[model samples]
Target: MTETKELSRLKLLAKRYARANRIAQHQALDLVAGELGFPNWNKLISVSKKGWLADSVQMASIEAFVTRALPAAIFRDGDPEAMARRFAHLEQAERGMIGDHTYRLQEILHEVIIAGEGWSIRIPENPGAIPIVETFTNQERECPALEPEFLQKALELARDRAVQVRAEISADWPRRSTKPDQSGMVRHPLCRGESDVWFCLHCDGKITSAQIAQNLWHCPACGASPLDIFDTAFWSDDKGESFLPVKTDGSTDRDELDFRIVDSRPKLDLTEEKIILLIRSALLDDATNISEKLGALQAEISVDDENGVWIIIEEDLWPEGKDPVQALAVAKLLGLEVERLSSWSTIPFAWPRLGEIASSTCDYTQMMLDAYAQYGGSPTK
Candidate 1:
């Protein structure tokens, strides 16, 4: 018999992780259960009631494995409780294999699971790339899931949770099989070198014959789909059965796949350069006879690491020196980050025939507002 109960060992492991990550011991336990194939601590206990007891030393060993295996969710907000609330809805880890690729259900950030890489958010500089933490050796798969995908998934999960009155599986429900990890898979026709080793047609990389199959013929390195998977290099144009489809039982359990596709949420590819062009176009819209003028004024825009977008236009755009200010206000209304490279105080302009001077930036702003108010316009939206 083991020295301590397995549940107790899990409890202990949770406490240790909680201490290490500075999260609550309970949330830590949930994270641990998620690390395992359970949705929560209670679920794990319920499922493993027969094997509640285990060796404490062995439990420690498993914890060691977890330390190396699991990616620590760095709660940067510094509040352990905040971390708990943030990840409160994350379901327990479910063991499922796609083709030959194995995955555990873990929330990366909201809906994004770094898949085999543990829970991690992509470093923002590479919004379109998967979060690939290079230090971990056993886990080195990247995917197409990016920042927009993350947001989309999170929203879907939230919406699903709201409508999910209960958690029961149905025949029509799009879910993985009971023992998702054990789902049947087939080897790719194009990448097979040996019986068990294979090549990734998309990356020109190698994969464990089991891996590419398990990953649903998706390239773990470059996130290629099954369409790109091939059995051979078709060496020497032999035109063999390399292009022919090899029949298989079916796909790996795709729990998140159906959920993620609910909205074909395309990547929000609005880059800084694009934002500048958009702002310039909007500015032209806001001012009368300013399209060619603003276009002539050389626009420069930038987005900082902190997500502030800076815009620079010629000084002559606003004789009253409010061009960037007006643009900033517009950007703010749109919840955009915009900065000005060159700014100036008012150089008042005389009204036609009248001596009324729009001297200050505020005056020019009010003038535009009054004009808009008279002309029935909605500028802020």
Candidate 2:
């Protein structure tokens, strides 16, 4: 039982490793087994059946091995320890003072998100893409990102997270796709096409193998994800021969942060459909009998461009001279002019007047069924 518990702990560690590195659980398990001096996970399990359990030191070693950035194929030196130390400064629950305001840093969905009281910044997975800084309030204050020190700190935190995310992405891809050869030739992970120059289907930009590798397979020209990049532009008739070269100047670096304030407050828009729905609900509130309720359900309501509501109530279900007071009050509240009209139409039941005479719908239904049986052939019809 103790051995089984140790094995379960190893499996949980493998799951965490798989999630962090964006690899399959089986692949992570094999890597874990390799770290523990086993050839593969199957071999490790076979050995575990012979009464083997991992000690605290061995478990810590396995965790440390799996915690490092995976594959090491993206780095020129192929050193995982150096890669781990590069982002070791950022803690799991990190917070810093950017000017007078405090900002909290967190990694969500492989993106670095730093949020403050009224503003938040999101650094996407693609390194070439610009960081999005959104402000909640509109007090006309100076943008915090415009400050040099604040922007630098935010960029540092974001870039570190981006590097880890890029490493994870590279680990999932083929080694040939991430690392180009001496002749600058690379393989497309999706199409298996090998070429020195690639084409982006999203923006029709021609990309060299080095440029794509530098951008982590994302299109530097349009900031499109790796899925949109292909070795050949199969969609084009000329195979992207006439395409322009993608300009990647300053894509990997940002000297200045663009500041833009967007208002994200809740806005209530009284569209035509919304106005009609509100008016119909008001008509339902005004209904006193089942016949009146059917009249409200069958009412044809429309809103004009001049903020006027037109409602046509059925004359047989609704009274002739009676006005819908609740509907008029609702229209007034919405600052709309109401035009109510009556029309004769076929109702669901034969005796529409019986609904008005009875107190409840059940009594009206039974009374209508008896009337239908006495006058017509059958109530089922």
Candidate 2 lDDT over 1-381, as tens digits, reads 355877998998887666554445687798789778887899999988887788999999887765555322323243547455454544432687755867888778768788777677787877677777776655677667656787666765665666566666666677667657778798876765899998888999999987887677789888888799987799999989999999764236444664333455466997898889999999999999988998999999999889899999999999988899999999999999999999887778887888888888789888988898889878654
Which prediction has the highest lDDT against the true structure?
A: 2
Poorest 10 consecutive residues by lDDT, candidate 2: 70-79
Q: State the RMSD for candidate 2.
A: 10.4
Q: Positional deviation of 5 in candidate 2, in angstroms?
A: 32
User: What is the C-alpha lDDT profile of model 1 across 233-310, one tens digit per residue?
Assistant: 544254332433223222332223232222222446777667667677666554543322443244566667676777
State the weakest 10-residue window (summed lDDT) of model 1. 163-172
Model 1: CA > 4 A from native: 1-198, 203-278, 290-297, 303-311, 315-326, 334-381
| Structural similarity to truth (TM-score) of each candidate | 0.26, 0.63
Cα deviation at 167, candidate 2, in Å, is 2.8
lDDT agreement of model 1 with the native:
0.43
- Clashes by residue pair, model 2: none
